[model samples]
Target: MNAFNEISKSTAAFFVQAGASFGVSFLGAIGGIYFLPLDPWQRLFLGMTVLFLVASSFTLAKVIRDQQEASTIRVRLDEARMEKLLAEHNPFSAA
Candidate 1:
């Protein structure tokens, strides 16, 4: 169990670091391309940039959705706990 926990933590940290690095480098590339001369090469780079942005946007949306679901679950758990406490406080309240 200890080894599993450590491995999980390390893997999560690695992804976090990788994501940050990728984000920064991706932004830098997009910025650099803006100053490139307008030619077939520049157009190709722009097309690729748009594709990357679209793909990342889709991925981010899915992450947001999963997070939203998790948040809802937490909210429901808290509500259940609160109700349990309330019932304990008032047996006749018909909670």
Candidate 2:
């Protein structure tokens, strides 16, 4: 119900999906390598495989980084807000 919980749930979902996609792509790449003939056309498949692998890796990194950043921001923001509320309510603090 809270912002932090919501963010965590969505971020977890994204990571799961990203991981699944990466796995599928990896399997497909392996299959493609084996099915492609070793002719000039094979170069095309090789290029595509390389590009797919690179792009998938980049995508995975970006998703992980983004989720990490989001989680960090949520934690810091919650901490700041709690600190502010605590400061406001504390009877021991000097005026």
| Candidate achieving the largest TM-score | 2
The local distance difference test score of model 2 is 0.80
Give the TM-score comparing model 2 with the true structure, all chains together: 0.55
| Per-residue alpha-carbon lDDT of candidate 1 for residues 1-95, written as tens digits (9 for 90 to 100) | 65434543547688899889878877777767776778878768796977788699879989997897688678978998999988779656666
User: Model 1: clashing residue pairs?
Assistant: none
Give lDDT tens digits, candidate 2, residues 1-95.
67655765657688899889978977787677767767867767786877877889799989998999888889999999999998879687788
Q: Would you list the C-alpha lDDT of every candidate in the order shown?
A: 0.77, 0.80
Evaluated with lDDT, which candidate comes out highest? 2
Runs in model 1 deviating more than 4 A are: 1-38, 89-95
Evaluated at residue 3, the lDDT of candidate 2 is 69
**Model 1, position 33: C-alpha lDDT score:** 71
